[model samples]
Target: MSQHARLPLTLDQLWQFSLQYYSAREIKEACLHLQNHFHGNVNLLLMLKWLDEAKLTFAPQDWSKITQSLGNIESLLRDYRELRRKLKVHVSDSLYKETLHFELQLEKQQQTALVNCINSLTLTDCEHPHLVEQYCLQLGAERLVRIFIQPVSSQSHNL
Candidate 1:
Protein backbone atom coordinates (compact mmCIF):
# COMPACT_ATOMS: atom_id res chain seq x y z
CA MET A 1 0.00 0.00 0.00
CA SER A 2 2.94 2.21 -0.36
CA GLN A 3 4.57 3.18 -3.62
CA HIS A 4 6.93 1.21 -5.82
CA ALA A 5 6.76 -2.44 -6.80
CA ARG A 6 9.08 -3.80 -4.09
CA LEU A 7 12.38 -3.47 -2.25
CA PRO A 8 14.57 -5.13 -4.85
CA LEU A 9 12.46 -3.62 -7.69
CA THR A 10 13.54 -6.45 -9.91
CA LEU A 11 15.25 -9.35 -8.20
CA ASP A 12 16.79 -10.54 -11.43
CA GLN A 13 17.24 -7.02 -12.68
CA LEU A 14 18.80 -5.72 -9.50
CA TRP A 15 20.90 -8.84 -9.07
CA GLN A 16 22.13 -8.50 -12.61
CA PHE A 17 22.97 -4.91 -11.87
CA SER A 18 24.69 -5.85 -8.60
CA LEU A 19 26.70 -8.58 -10.28
CA GLN A 20 27.61 -6.28 -13.13
CA TYR A 21 28.24 -3.29 -10.92
CA TYR A 22 28.50 -3.95 -7.21
CA SER A 23 29.70 -7.53 -7.10
CA ALA A 24 31.68 -8.24 -10.21
CA ARG A 25 34.47 -10.61 -9.18
CA GLU A 26 36.85 -7.69 -9.05
CA ILE A 27 34.28 -5.28 -7.74
CA LYS A 28 32.99 -7.84 -5.27
CA GLU A 29 36.47 -8.26 -3.93
CA ALA A 30 36.64 -4.53 -3.50
CA CYS A 31 33.21 -4.47 -1.94
CA LEU A 32 34.04 -7.29 0.47
CA HIS A 33 37.30 -5.56 1.22
CA LEU A 34 35.31 -2.47 2.02
CA GLN A 35 32.94 -4.53 4.10
CA ASN A 36 35.56 -6.34 6.17
CA HIS A 37 37.68 -3.27 6.61
CA PHE A 38 35.01 -0.59 6.75
CA HIS A 39 31.84 -2.15 8.18
CA GLY A 40 29.94 -1.24 5.05
CA ASN A 41 26.56 -2.85 4.47
CA VAL A 42 26.54 -4.84 1.24
CA ASN A 43 22.76 -5.09 1.32
CA LEU A 44 22.48 -1.35 1.59
CA LEU A 45 25.01 -1.04 -1.15
CA LEU A 46 22.91 -3.29 -3.32
CA MET A 47 19.73 -1.51 -2.29
CA LEU A 48 21.16 1.84 -3.23
CA LYS A 49 22.18 0.38 -6.55
CA TRP A 50 18.66 -0.94 -7.00
CA LEU A 51 17.21 2.46 -6.16
CA ASP A 52 19.42 4.11 -8.70
CA GLU A 53 18.53 1.49 -11.26
CA ALA A 54 14.81 2.00 -10.63
CA LYS A 55 15.28 5.77 -10.70
CA LEU A 56 13.70 5.89 -7.27
CA THR A 57 14.19 7.60 -3.96
CA PHE A 58 12.78 7.21 -0.47
CA ALA A 59 10.80 9.69 1.53
CA PRO A 60 12.26 10.62 4.91
CA GLN A 61 9.51 8.71 6.65
CA ASP A 62 10.18 5.70 4.49
CA TRP A 63 13.89 5.93 5.10
CA SER A 64 13.36 6.06 8.84
CA LYS A 65 11.99 2.55 8.85
CA ILE A 66 14.38 1.42 6.19
CA THR A 67 17.38 2.70 8.07
CA GLN A 68 16.14 1.38 11.37
CA SER A 69 15.51 -2.04 9.97
CA LEU A 70 18.85 -2.02 8.25
CA GLY A 71 20.51 -1.22 11.53
CA ASN A 72 18.87 -4.18 13.20
CA ILE A 73 19.74 -6.55 10.40
CA GLU A 74 23.26 -5.27 10.19
CA SER A 75 23.79 -5.95 13.85
CA LEU A 76 22.55 -9.48 13.46
CA LEU A 77 24.66 -9.94 10.37
CA ARG A 78 27.73 -8.75 12.19
CA ASP A 79 27.12 -11.12 15.03
CA TYR A 80 26.55 -14.06 12.73
CA ARG A 81 29.53 -13.14 10.66
CA GLU A 82 31.74 -13.12 13.70
CA LEU A 83 30.35 -16.42 14.83
CA ARG A 84 30.88 -17.89 11.41
CA ARG A 85 34.43 -16.66 11.36
CA LYS A 86 35.10 -18.22 14.72
CA LEU A 87 33.45 -21.41 13.57
CA LYS A 88 35.54 -21.48 10.43
CA VAL A 89 38.61 -22.59 12.35
CA HIS A 90 36.73 -25.69 13.30
CA VAL A 91 35.49 -26.60 9.84
CA SER A 92 36.70 -30.16 10.31
CA ASP A 93 33.66 -30.52 12.50
CA SER A 94 30.62 -30.86 10.28
CA LEU A 95 28.57 -29.21 13.00
CA TYR A 96 30.61 -26.07 12.77
CA LYS A 97 30.30 -25.88 9.02
CA GLU A 98 26.58 -26.52 9.21
CA THR A 99 26.25 -23.79 11.76
CA LEU A 100 28.14 -21.40 9.56
CA HIS A 101 26.01 -22.32 6.60
CA PHE A 102 22.87 -21.79 8.65
CA GLU A 103 24.11 -18.41 9.69
CA LEU A 104 24.80 -17.55 6.08
CA GLN A 105 21.31 -18.56 5.05
CA LEU A 106 19.80 -16.64 7.92
CA GLU A 107 21.73 -13.56 6.88
CA LYS A 108 20.43 -13.95 3.37
CA GLN A 109 16.89 -14.31 4.63
CA GLN A 110 17.30 -11.23 6.78
CA GLN A 111 18.55 -9.31 3.80
CA THR A 112 15.59 -10.48 1.75
CA ALA A 113 13.26 -9.38 4.52
CA LEU A 114 14.92 -6.01 4.63
CA VAL A 115 14.34 -5.65 0.91
CA ASN A 116 10.73 -6.65 1.23
CA CYS A 117 10.27 -4.10 3.97
CA ILE A 118 11.86 -1.47 1.78
CA ASN A 119 9.54 -2.41 -1.05
CA SER A 120 6.60 -1.80 1.25
CA LEU A 121 7.41 1.87 1.60
CA THR A 122 6.51 4.92 -0.43
CA LEU A 123 9.02 6.51 -2.78
CA THR A 124 9.32 10.11 -3.87
CA ASP A 125 11.11 11.60 -6.81
CA CYS A 126 14.87 11.38 -6.49
CA GLU A 127 15.41 15.08 -5.87
CA HIS A 128 19.16 14.86 -5.87
CA PRO A 129 20.03 11.69 -7.65
CA HIS A 130 23.51 11.99 -6.21
CA LEU A 131 22.14 11.28 -2.75
CA VAL A 132 22.40 7.61 -3.57
CA GLU A 133 26.11 8.06 -4.06
CA GLN A 134 26.43 10.28 -1.02
CA TYR A 135 24.18 8.28 1.26
CA CYS A 136 26.96 6.70 3.30
CA LEU A 137 29.80 9.02 2.45
CA GLN A 138 29.63 10.90 5.74
CA LEU A 139 29.61 7.65 7.68
CA GLY A 140 33.17 6.85 6.71
CA ALA A 141 31.98 3.86 4.81
CA GLU A 142 30.71 2.99 1.31
CA ARG A 143 33.87 3.57 -0.66
CA LEU A 144 33.46 0.57 -2.96
CA VAL A 145 33.12 2.96 -5.91
CA ARG A 146 30.72 5.76 -6.69
CA ILE A 147 29.72 4.68 -10.17
CA PHE A 148 28.31 1.28 -11.17
CA ILE A 149 27.56 1.87 -14.83
CA GLN A 150 29.11 -0.37 -17.37
CA PRO A 151 31.47 1.36 -19.76
CA VAL A 152 29.84 1.63 -23.11
CA SER A 153 32.10 2.59 -25.97
CA SER A 154 28.93 2.71 -28.00
CA GLN A 155 26.73 4.72 -25.62
CA SER A 156 27.41 7.36 -23.01
CA HIS A 157 27.53 5.53 -19.65
CA ASN A 158 25.59 6.24 -16.46
CA LEU A 159 24.51 4.14 -13.45
Candidate 2:
Protein backbone atom coordinates (compact mmCIF):
# COMPACT_ATOMS: atom_id res chain seq x y z
CA MET A 1 0.00 0.00 0.00
CA SER A 2 1.08 3.56 -0.60
CA GLN A 3 2.00 5.72 2.42
CA HIS A 4 -1.09 7.89 1.82
CA ALA A 5 -3.36 4.82 1.73
CA ARG A 6 -1.96 3.62 5.05
CA LEU A 7 -2.47 6.96 6.85
CA PRO A 8 -5.46 7.43 9.18
CA LEU A 9 -7.55 10.45 8.28
CA THR A 10 -8.01 13.25 10.80
CA LEU A 11 -11.31 15.11 11.24
CA ASP A 12 -10.29 17.73 8.71
CA GLN A 13 -9.10 14.99 6.37
CA LEU A 14 -12.34 13.01 6.82
CA TRP A 15 -14.42 16.13 6.26
CA GLN A 16 -12.57 16.88 3.05
CA PHE A 17 -12.74 13.27 1.87
CA SER A 18 -16.41 12.96 2.69
CA LEU A 19 -17.09 16.08 0.68
CA GLN A 20 -15.08 14.68 -2.23
CA TYR A 21 -15.75 10.95 -2.06
CA TYR A 22 -19.51 11.25 -2.39
CA SER A 23 -21.80 13.15 -4.66
CA ALA A 24 -23.28 16.39 -3.28
CA ARG A 25 -26.54 14.62 -2.55
CA GLU A 26 -24.76 11.96 -0.53
CA ILE A 27 -22.82 14.59 1.38
CA LYS A 28 -26.02 16.44 2.15
CA GLU A 29 -27.67 13.28 3.42
CA ALA A 30 -24.74 12.61 5.71
CA CYS A 31 -24.84 16.21 6.95
CA LEU A 32 -28.53 15.89 7.69
CA HIS A 33 -27.91 12.70 9.62
CA LEU A 34 -25.10 14.20 11.68
CA GLN A 35 -26.97 17.45 12.28
CA ASN A 36 -30.06 15.58 13.33
CA HIS A 37 -28.02 13.50 15.75
CA PHE A 38 -26.12 16.39 17.31
CA HIS A 39 -28.48 19.34 17.24
CA GLY A 40 -31.72 17.84 16.02
CA ASN A 41 -32.80 18.61 12.46
CA VAL A 42 -34.22 22.12 12.89
CA ASN A 43 -31.52 24.13 14.65
CA LEU A 44 -28.48 22.56 13.04
CA LEU A 45 -29.49 23.47 9.51
CA LEU A 46 -30.65 26.92 10.61
CA MET A 47 -27.49 27.58 12.60
CA LEU A 48 -25.33 26.50 9.71
CA LYS A 49 -27.19 28.71 7.26
CA TRP A 50 -27.44 31.63 9.64
CA LEU A 51 -23.76 31.49 10.34
CA ASP A 52 -23.02 31.43 6.65
CA GLU A 53 -25.36 34.27 5.85
CA ALA A 54 -24.25 36.58 8.65
CA LYS A 55 -20.61 35.73 8.03
CA LEU A 56 -20.43 34.77 11.68
CA THR A 57 -19.71 31.65 13.67
CA PHE A 58 -21.15 30.01 16.76
CA ALA A 59 -19.46 30.02 20.12
CA PRO A 60 -19.96 27.01 22.40
CA GLN A 61 -22.52 28.90 24.46
CA ASP A 62 -24.60 29.77 21.43
CA TRP A 63 -24.39 26.25 20.03
CA SER A 64 -25.66 24.72 23.28
CA LYS A 65 -28.73 26.96 23.28
CA ILE A 66 -29.38 26.33 19.63
CA THR A 67 -29.27 22.58 20.22
CA GLN A 68 -31.77 22.93 23.03
CA SER A 69 -34.07 24.96 20.78
CA LEU A 70 -33.82 22.30 18.08
CA GLY A 71 -34.84 19.65 20.58
CA ASN A 72 -38.03 21.61 21.19
CA ILE A 73 -38.65 21.83 17.47
CA GLU A 74 -38.10 18.08 17.03
CA SER A 75 -40.69 17.37 19.70
CA LEU A 76 -43.16 19.70 18.04
CA LEU A 77 -42.64 18.04 14.65
CA ARG A 78 -43.15 14.60 16.19
CA ASP A 79 -46.43 15.71 17.74
CA TYR A 80 -47.58 17.27 14.49
CA ARG A 81 -46.71 14.13 12.55
CA GLU A 82 -48.63 11.98 14.99
CA LEU A 83 -51.60 14.31 14.87
CA ARG A 84 -51.57 14.26 11.09
CA ARG A 85 -51.51 10.46 11.04
CA LYS A 86 -54.35 10.27 13.54
CA LEU A 87 -56.36 12.83 11.62
CA LYS A 88 -56.17 10.58 8.59
CA VAL A 89 -58.15 7.84 10.32
CA HIS A 90 -60.08 9.26 13.25
CA VAL A 91 -61.36 12.57 11.96
CA SER A 92 -64.18 13.35 9.55
CA ASP A 93 -63.29 14.62 6.08
CA SER A 94 -64.49 18.16 6.89
CA LEU A 95 -62.73 18.16 10.23
CA TYR A 96 -59.58 16.86 8.64
CA LYS A 97 -59.71 19.60 6.07
CA GLU A 98 -60.10 22.22 8.79
CA THR A 99 -57.24 20.79 10.79
CA LEU A 100 -55.02 20.85 7.77
CA HIS A 101 -56.04 24.41 7.06
CA PHE A 102 -55.09 25.41 10.57
CA GLU A 103 -51.78 23.62 10.31
CA LEU A 104 -50.98 25.37 7.04
CA GLN A 105 -51.83 28.72 8.56
CA LEU A 106 -49.68 27.95 11.53
CA GLU A 107 -46.92 26.99 9.17
CA LYS A 108 -47.24 30.32 7.39
CA GLN A 109 -47.13 32.23 10.64
CA GLN A 110 -44.02 30.36 11.63
CA GLN A 111 -42.46 31.18 8.29
CA THR A 112 -43.12 34.87 8.75
CA ALA A 113 -41.70 34.80 12.21
CA LEU A 114 -38.65 33.05 10.90
CA VAL A 115 -38.12 35.66 8.23
CA ASN A 116 -38.49 38.40 10.78
CA CYS A 117 -36.01 36.63 12.97
CA ILE A 118 -33.49 36.48 10.18
CA ASN A 119 -34.09 40.13 9.52
CA SER A 120 -33.36 40.87 13.13
CA LEU A 121 -29.80 39.61 12.95
CA THR A 122 -27.16 42.33 12.62
CA LEU A 123 -23.45 42.64 13.24
CA THR A 124 -24.13 44.95 16.15
CA ASP A 125 -26.01 42.24 18.04
CA CYS A 126 -22.82 40.27 18.41
CA GLU A 127 -21.38 42.59 21.03
CA HIS A 128 -24.08 42.53 23.65
CA PRO A 129 -25.49 39.53 25.54
CA HIS A 130 -28.98 41.09 25.64
CA LEU A 131 -28.84 41.64 21.91
CA VAL A 132 -27.78 38.06 21.55
CA GLU A 133 -31.00 37.09 23.33
CA GLN A 134 -33.07 38.93 20.74
CA TYR A 135 -30.94 37.51 17.99
CA CYS A 136 -31.51 33.99 19.23
CA LEU A 137 -35.26 34.45 19.52
CA GLN A 138 -35.36 35.51 15.92
CA LEU A 139 -33.04 32.68 14.93
CA GLY A 140 -35.20 30.14 16.74
CA ALA A 141 -38.30 31.48 15.05
CA GLU A 142 -36.61 31.31 11.66
CA ARG A 143 -35.33 27.82 12.30
CA LEU A 144 -38.93 26.57 12.66
CA VAL A 145 -39.81 28.26 9.41
CA ARG A 146 -36.96 26.44 7.70
CA ILE A 147 -38.06 23.14 9.18
CA PHE A 148 -41.60 23.64 7.90
CA ILE A 149 -40.35 24.50 4.45
CA GLN A 150 -37.64 21.87 4.00
CA PRO A 151 -38.91 18.35 4.19
CA VAL A 152 -36.30 15.72 3.39
CA SER A 153 -38.03 14.73 0.15
CA SER A 154 -38.46 18.29 -1.09
CA GLN A 155 -35.00 19.55 -0.16
CA SER A 156 -33.41 18.44 -3.42
CA HIS A 157 -36.08 20.26 -5.36
CA ASN A 158 -34.89 23.56 -3.90
CA LEU A 159 -31.34 22.87 -4.99
Candidate 3:
Protein backbone atom coordinates (compact mmCIF):
# COMPACT_ATOMS: atom_id res chain seq x y z
CA MET A 1 0.00 0.00 0.00
CA SER A 2 1.05 3.58 -0.50
CA GLN A 3 0.71 6.76 1.54
CA HIS A 4 -2.09 8.15 -0.57
CA ALA A 5 -5.63 7.15 0.28
CA ARG A 6 -7.56 5.10 -2.22
CA LEU A 7 -10.70 6.56 -3.75
CA PRO A 8 -13.90 4.62 -4.29
CA LEU A 9 -15.39 5.02 -7.72
CA THR A 10 -18.80 4.12 -9.06
CA LEU A 11 -19.62 2.62 -12.45
CA ASP A 12 -20.78 5.99 -13.75
CA GLN A 13 -17.52 7.56 -12.66
CA LEU A 14 -15.54 4.92 -14.47
CA TRP A 15 -17.64 5.31 -17.57
CA GLN A 16 -17.19 9.06 -17.54
CA PHE A 17 -13.48 8.68 -17.02
CA SER A 18 -13.28 6.27 -19.92
CA LEU A 19 -15.19 8.60 -22.19
CA GLN A 20 -12.98 11.52 -21.33
CA TYR A 21 -9.80 9.53 -21.62
CA TYR A 22 -10.81 7.91 -24.87
CA SER A 23 -11.68 11.29 -26.32
CA ALA A 24 -8.01 12.11 -26.48
CA ARG A 25 -6.69 11.16 -29.93
CA GLU A 26 -3.41 9.84 -28.57
CA ILE A 27 -5.07 7.76 -25.89
CA LYS A 28 -7.53 6.44 -28.46
CA GLU A 29 -4.75 5.55 -30.85
CA ALA A 30 -2.67 3.93 -28.16
CA CYS A 31 -5.57 1.81 -26.95
CA LEU A 32 -6.42 0.76 -30.50
CA HIS A 33 -2.78 0.00 -31.13
CA LEU A 34 -2.72 -2.26 -28.11
CA GLN A 35 -5.94 -3.93 -29.18
CA ASN A 36 -4.88 -4.41 -32.80
CA HIS A 37 -1.28 -5.46 -32.31
CA PHE A 38 -1.16 -7.09 -28.91
CA HIS A 39 -4.64 -8.57 -28.65
CA GLY A 40 -5.34 -6.34 -25.66
CA ASN A 41 -8.85 -5.75 -24.41
CA VAL A 42 -9.50 -1.99 -24.47
CA ASN A 43 -12.05 -2.14 -21.67
CA LEU A 44 -9.56 -3.87 -19.41
CA LEU A 45 -6.95 -1.29 -20.24
CA LEU A 46 -9.49 1.42 -19.41
CA MET A 47 -10.24 -0.34 -16.14
CA LEU A 48 -6.54 -0.23 -15.33
CA LYS A 49 -6.55 3.48 -16.06
CA TRP A 50 -9.60 3.98 -13.89
CA LEU A 51 -7.91 2.13 -11.04
CA ASP A 52 -4.78 4.18 -11.43
CA GLU A 53 -6.74 7.40 -11.36
CA ALA A 54 -8.64 6.29 -8.28
CA LYS A 55 -5.44 5.33 -6.48
CA LEU A 56 -6.68 1.78 -6.06
CA THR A 57 -4.82 -1.46 -6.62
CA PHE A 58 -6.07 -5.01 -6.70
CA ALA A 59 -4.33 -8.30 -6.05
CA PRO A 60 -3.61 -10.85 -8.74
CA GLN A 61 -6.55 -12.97 -7.65
CA ASP A 62 -8.85 -9.99 -7.92
CA TRP A 63 -7.57 -9.28 -11.41
CA SER A 64 -8.15 -12.91 -12.31
CA LYS A 65 -11.77 -12.62 -11.26
CA ILE A 66 -12.26 -9.44 -13.26
CA THR A 67 -10.76 -10.99 -16.36
CA GLN A 68 -12.80 -14.14 -15.90
CA SER A 69 -16.01 -12.15 -15.66
CA LEU A 70 -15.23 -10.51 -18.95
CA GLY A 71 -14.41 -13.74 -20.80
CA ASN A 72 -17.73 -14.29 -22.60
CA ILE A 73 -18.32 -10.63 -23.32
CA GLU A 74 -14.77 -10.22 -24.55
CA SER A 75 -15.25 -12.93 -27.13
CA LEU A 76 -18.44 -11.31 -28.35
CA LEU A 77 -16.80 -7.91 -28.53
CA ARG A 78 -13.87 -9.32 -30.48
CA ASP A 79 -16.14 -10.99 -32.99
CA TYR A 80 -18.11 -7.80 -33.49
CA ARG A 81 -14.94 -5.74 -33.79
CA GLU A 82 -13.54 -8.08 -36.41
CA LEU A 83 -16.81 -7.91 -38.32
CA ARG A 84 -16.83 -4.14 -38.10
CA ARG A 85 -13.29 -3.95 -39.44
CA LYS A 86 -14.06 -6.32 -42.27
CA LEU A 87 -17.11 -4.33 -43.22
CA LYS A 88 -15.27 -1.01 -43.36
CA VAL A 89 -14.06 -1.60 -46.90
CA HIS A 90 -16.65 -4.01 -48.26
CA VAL A 91 -19.90 -2.62 -46.93
CA SER A 92 -21.95 0.55 -47.33
CA ASP A 93 -21.18 3.46 -45.01
CA SER A 94 -24.41 3.02 -43.04
CA LEU A 95 -23.78 -0.71 -42.67
CA TYR A 96 -20.29 -0.12 -41.37
CA LYS A 97 -21.63 2.51 -38.96
CA GLU A 98 -24.20 0.05 -37.65
CA THR A 99 -21.52 -2.53 -37.00
CA LEU A 100 -19.36 0.06 -35.25
CA HIS A 101 -22.33 1.09 -33.11
CA PHE A 102 -23.00 -2.48 -32.05
CA GLU A 103 -19.33 -2.97 -31.26
CA LEU A 104 -19.45 0.11 -28.98
CA GLN A 105 -22.48 -1.33 -27.23
CA LEU A 106 -20.61 -4.56 -26.60
CA GLU A 107 -17.69 -2.56 -25.27
CA LYS A 108 -20.01 -0.78 -22.83
CA GLN A 109 -21.40 -4.10 -21.66
CA GLN A 110 -17.87 -5.34 -21.00
CA GLN A 111 -17.11 -2.22 -18.99
CA THR A 112 -20.24 -2.71 -16.91
CA ALA A 113 -19.26 -6.29 -16.17
CA LEU A 114 -15.78 -5.16 -15.25
CA VAL A 115 -17.07 -2.60 -12.77
CA ASN A 116 -19.33 -5.19 -11.18
CA CYS A 117 -16.43 -7.60 -10.80
CA ILE A 118 -14.26 -4.85 -9.33
CA ASN A 119 -16.95 -3.92 -6.82
CA SER A 120 -16.76 -7.41 -5.34
CA LEU A 121 -13.01 -7.36 -4.84
CA THR A 122 -10.67 -6.04 -2.20
CA LEU A 123 -8.40 -3.25 -3.31
CA THR A 124 -5.64 -1.19 -1.69
CA ASP A 125 -3.82 2.08 -2.09
CA CYS A 126 -0.66 1.16 -3.95
CA GLU A 127 1.53 2.30 -6.79
CA HIS A 128 -0.08 1.57 -10.15
CA PRO A 129 2.87 1.54 -12.56
CA HIS A 130 3.90 -1.96 -11.53
CA LEU A 131 0.36 -3.20 -11.94
CA VAL A 132 0.10 -1.59 -15.37
CA GLU A 133 3.42 -3.11 -16.35
CA GLN A 134 2.33 -6.54 -15.16
CA TYR A 135 -0.76 -6.41 -17.38
CA CYS A 136 0.98 -4.96 -20.45
CA LEU A 137 3.87 -7.40 -20.06
CA GLN A 138 1.39 -10.25 -19.99
CA LEU A 139 0.16 -9.00 -23.36
CA GLY A 140 3.75 -8.75 -24.63
CA ALA A 141 3.20 -5.04 -25.16
CA GLU A 142 5.42 -3.72 -22.42
CA ARG A 143 6.94 -1.11 -24.69
CA LEU A 144 3.55 0.56 -25.15
CA VAL A 145 3.02 1.13 -21.43
CA ARG A 146 4.47 4.60 -21.66
CA ILE A 147 1.63 5.70 -23.91
CA PHE A 148 -0.82 4.91 -21.15
CA ILE A 149 1.06 6.42 -18.23
CA GLN A 150 2.27 9.54 -19.95
CA PRO A 151 1.02 12.91 -18.75
CA VAL A 152 -2.17 14.10 -20.41
CA SER A 153 -0.54 17.38 -21.38
CA SER A 154 2.09 15.49 -23.32
CA GLN A 155 -0.46 13.76 -25.45
CA SER A 156 -2.19 15.29 -28.47
CA HIS A 157 -5.96 15.35 -28.37
CA ASN A 158 -8.88 16.23 -30.61
CA LEU A 159 -11.21 17.09 -27.79
In terms of TM-score, the best-performing candidate is 3
Model 1 C-alpha lDDT versus the unseen true structure: 0.59
Candidate with the greatest lDDT versus the true structure: 3
Segments of candidate 3 deviating more than 4 angstroms? 1-8, 127-129, 151-159
Error of 2 at 78 (Å): 1.9
Model 2 Cα displacement at 154 (Å)?
A: 20
lDDT of 3 by residue, 1-159 (tens): 433233344667677778888898988998898989999888888888767655577877776787798888888878877777777999899988888778778888888888788777777776444565667889999888887876444132221
Candidates ranked by TM-score: 3, 1, 2
User: Any runs in candidate 2 off by more than 4 Å, and if so which?
Assistant: 1-39, 70-74, 89-101, 104-159
TM-score of 2: 0.35
lDDT of each: 0.59, 0.40, 0.75
* Residue 69 in model 1: lDDT: 69
Query: Residue 10 of model 1: what lDDT?
Result: 41
- lDDT score at residue 137, model 3, on the 0-100 scale: 86
Question: How well is each residue in 90-118 modelled by candidate 1, as lDDT tens digits?
Answer: 67778886886786566565567656676
Number of backbone-clashing residue pairs for each candidate, in the order shown: 2, 1, 0
Better of 1 and 3 by TM-score: 3
Candidate 2 — worst ten consecutive residues by lDDT sum?
1-10
RMSD values for the candidates in order, in angstroms, are 4.9, 15.4, 3.8
